[model samples]
Target: MEQRHKDLLRENRVFLIDNLIMKNFIDHVAELLTANMEDTIMSNATNHEQVGCFLNILERRGKGAYQKFIEALTDAECDHVRSHLEQLEDEDCVDGYDDIDGPIRQETGNDDVDLHVSDWMKTDLSEEQRQTPISERAMAFVAREAVGVMEVGKLMGFTEGRLRQFQASSPIPSSQISTMFSAWRSQKGKQATVENFVRLMRDAEVDEQHLKNVITREYPPGDAMA
Candidate 1:
């Protein structure tokens, strides 16, 4: 009887562990899909063939095939996938699944500067909008305005061909962008207003006298700028 009980416990543990791992994988994929679709919907040209190409590269790189699949998913698909996976995970937990490999991990592999914007902007992007790296996030801002590569390049003071090359190389994953946008929506940046700054300075008891003293000491006679 004891042996039977031990075997049953072992089976339960295996089941729980598998389910938990599956849940984490699904969540990671969802984020990938979100980032990919932050701007343009996946084109008809981007069928399974392109996805397969990415999967092949990822598998070769040992980054996980499932993750590449998620990155290839469309914005619309990601929303559904995220919901379904979340539901499945919740059900497993309710049924006593508790063996997570770790707390959720964020996807942070791709860092090509060209992919900074569209890669961080697209569908339902609350999280990306909030936590996207500044450089990447800035691109999305310009892209949303429909600023073409040439226009953006001009703004950045780069040549058009160079900008296009950058854009081509750093193709943004819609899933990642979507998740970032979700985060973005719920967050607010610090308002760099005069009133707010003054309020903060006052709260800290900083006044013109403090500023003048620091400036005078730092400048020291002829070193002061006009």
Candidate 2:
């Protein structure tokens, strides 16, 4: 199989099985590796053959193949597999696997980690809440509005691209984008307007094409249905 397919299989295996199942699979792989460990790594040709054989074994075993393989292995062999998996998990954690969410986040509206809401909120008040100028408030509010749009986009199955596109075209100024988004959201069941969106982006000096790309990621293109 292609490397991409192999990668996909690994991901599927990891996500579909819980810790116990994973342990069983690891045990099986360990047993296979141990049987040929002496020569498996010493010779590249043997390593390829062994890998193919291992994959064959796994395929024939089906969903519980790993567990079954483990059941047949000696206790010592099983320990080796367990140790390997522990090491893999530790490596994955230390490598910052959690940061992968930077591409597509689950918390669209809330910037807890990815969006950083605390920083955005700072713009909410000026020297004395004198209601900083509508222009600046409007710009600050864009972040809030973007949050809501992002949340809605996520609910609708939109991507990052689509969300940015919608934000770009809103008639609301960047300063008041948040309020505009809030107003649109309060409308209940009605989708946000796009005509006004175009007007706003034009005012903000945002590139129309660039916004389209952003929205493409956040929502679906051509159709904002997400």
Candidate 3:
């Protein structure tokens, strides 16, 4: 989760610093955070600094926290960054953005920038290996690696109708994955082991061998069944 946080901070710092990180967006994030961001950061920081500070705090919270922060940004009409995440694709070079090209930005005037917003998802375990029974990290990994609603649902034994409900209720795959994991754990009870969940992921073709390693070997002060 730390790396994802860093990448998001980097992305926002690079592209969003001037564009999305403004007073209106920061204020909206603060409102959404309620008490999460504390009074001091909200009251005493610049828009950019506040965002960094909030994310720094969230880095210790969990992926869900960062997700909510992104949602708050969306609520504030920062949809430009949202779309980049929505369809993890290489968008057409944003014609004429010249600043710091390669991975973050381009020069300007006559320059172009390629936006592969999917880069933040390169790492599987972004947070310190937590011992949550439901394995928040695993769910988040699947949410990032898995594709398509019905495909994942069917592979995990969710009926099309029920999967539709997840799609309806959760705006993003991360939330949908969490909701589905809740449903899965609720239904499966103590049977929802890390191995079982990993099976579902493999069946759905998420291809997370590294995550498998983490779950089976390195990560297990807690797995879903622990």
Candidate 4:
């Protein structure tokens, strides 16, 4: 998307989120935008997170998609969003970025995200809001809300053999998930972040329901969405 569009989306994100939550607009708008969002992503995500996904998808789909998206918003009586898109600056950005929108987003518009650890698991998210290594509070929220220990471990960079090894060794473990998290944190070192962790999970081709539940984590009340 143009930087103007990105800025528009960034500024009016809260209103659009509310609009999506209150109305039957998600599927309709997704159809218009050609995003084809998964059931898990739609069902388990919060209104705020859903809008994030929506905006990201819209941006990713680029020119062909944004017109449909804007038209849909206009149809939905989403004045805040419609007005912003319609009134965007004629000048386009060379790099096409918005400073406030630089967080490591959880939702993705890519294809074929694989599992297993890699140096590619670099983490740089929400520096505009929080640090990359995930603040303790954010980690706590992820650790608490997280389900599906084994899959999450894979997203966190664990291999199938290693998970089985742990299971075999610990036989009747009290908290396999917590233990997995500790290992992930230790391995990721400074890169262990809520954005990286959640994005990696959702970005995977698995499309597990767990990823949706993840980015919905509550940070401080009255965040940008609130």
Best by lDDT: 3
Give one digit per residue, the lDDT tens place, for model 4 in 1-226: 3435566677767766766652356655644232124343475557677666766555543233556776777677776756754555332233443332222232431232333222122221133323345444444434433434454566667898877765565433324555666677778887776556656544332223333333334333234331
Report the C-alpha lDDT of model 3 over 21-106, residue by residue, as the tens digit.
55566566542232424564567457767656655544434324456666876788878876664333223224322222223332
Where does model 2 exceed 4 Å of error? 1-48, 56-60, 69-78, 90-226
lDDT scores of the candidates, listed in order: 0.32, 0.38, 0.53, 0.49
lDDT of 2 by residue, 121-194 (tens): 23322222211222222333233213234443444345677567766776443323454444444442233333
Query: How does each model score on TM-score?
Result: 0.19, 0.20, 0.37, 0.35
Backbone collisions counted per model: 34, 29, 12, 0
Error of 1 at 32 (Å): 6.4
Candidate 3 residue runs with Cα over 4 Å from true position? 1-134, 213-226
Error of 1 at 152 (Å): 29
- TM value for model 2: 0.20
Which residue pairs in model 4 clash with each other?
Answer: none
Question: Candidate 3 overall Cα lDDT vs. reference?
Answer: 0.53
